[model samples]
Target: MKFCLKHGRCNCVEFYQGDLAAQADAPYILEADYKTWLDVIAGKLQPIPAMVLGKIKVKKGSFSVLAQYVTASLAMIKAAQKVGIQ
Candidate 1:
């Protein structure tokens, strides 16, 4: 999971996918609620590890939830490649 999140993150993907409509970076986040994001972060969801618990706080909108995941995925991928998680 970690590997898929942050592999070669520098150019593999946009670290900041700023949204044009929102005019803010890290846009393209997710479409989930705060609790949903929390659940994913708190090990209440599958395909995710318990380590992500509470590392980040949920926001008022979907962007907040999605951004964390996007950024996390990038990091995970990087870490995976870093440590040869494969």
Candidate 2:
């Protein structure tokens, strides 16, 4: 699955549930196991730590972009918490 958080908004702008090859191009592609994502959304794991711990994976993207979007990314995570994914 692919989730695109657009324009630095908390709301999910789009998502693709099929093979990534069929999805629209994105600057970043974050890949992780279900539990890893749950922990992130639940605030049990910070992204940096998770990355250091090898929980989260970036299949595509540039760290520079991620650094620039850090604030927006965190806000997006906080927004995801409202979805009750766990």
Candidate 3:
């Protein structure tokens, strides 16, 4: 995921099978403002809904291909929740 913190400055975080890395070139990139990401991570927003609403944008890969990983995506969110965010 590439988070657009502000302006055009962005940071990328990569996740693979529930593991996370500080940076990596992922096949699929999801881009959105920092606040939008916060909302999603905080469980205030659903990723799919956010994407549909345009709060999130796909910067790389195809949506159809990404959709195949919905389960993994949700699992990532769940794991993040378990780790908590501060």
Candidate 4:
């Protein structure tokens, strides 16, 4: 999955297979405003709900396909929370 945080411009983060990178080709691309991403990473909001609520938009993939990896997705958020924004 690739996440593009839209803060005027888009800053992208990609999770492909088991690797994470600033940019990469991915089958799934999720996009949202910067604050929405911050909320997601902070655990203030959950990804699925955010998507259902339309706070997060899937720009390049299917939500049903992405939903199958809920555990991995949440794990990614947890991992991000651990590292935090420097």
Q: Say which prediction, candidate 1 or candidate 2, comes out ahead on TM-score.
A: 2
Best by lDDT: 4
Which ranges of candidate 2 are over 4 A from the true structure?
1-7, 10-12, 16-24
Q: How do the residues 1-86 of candidate 4 rate in per-residue lDDT, one tens digit apiece?
A: 45564433337664553223224665666777889989999999999999999999887679999888788778778878999975
Question: What would the per-residue lDDT of candidate 2 be over residues 1-86, giving only the tens digit for each residue?
Answer: 44555564334455654365345577777677778878888888887667656686666777556766567767768877987783
Clashes by residue pair, model 4: none
Task: Return the TM-score for candidate 4, rounded to 2 decimals.
Answer: 0.71
The digit string of per-residue lDDT tens for model 3 on 25-65 reads 55566777778878877889988878878898876678877
Better of 1 and 2 by lDDT: 2
Candidate 3 positional error at 73, Å: 1.0
Give the lDDT of residue 61 in candidate 4: 72
Model 2 TM-score?
0.71
Lowest lDDT 10-residue stretch of candidate 2: 9-18
lDDT of 1 by residue, 8-80 (tens): 4443333222233243334233334445544544445532332235434232245335545655654544443
**What TM-score goes with each of the models?**
0.29, 0.71, 0.67, 0.71
Clashes of 2: 0
What is the RMSD, in Å, between candidate 1 and the native fold over all Cα?
10.2
Tell me the whole-model lDDT of each prediction, alpha carbons only: 0.39, 0.68, 0.67, 0.76
Pick the winner on lDDT between candidates 3 and 4.
4
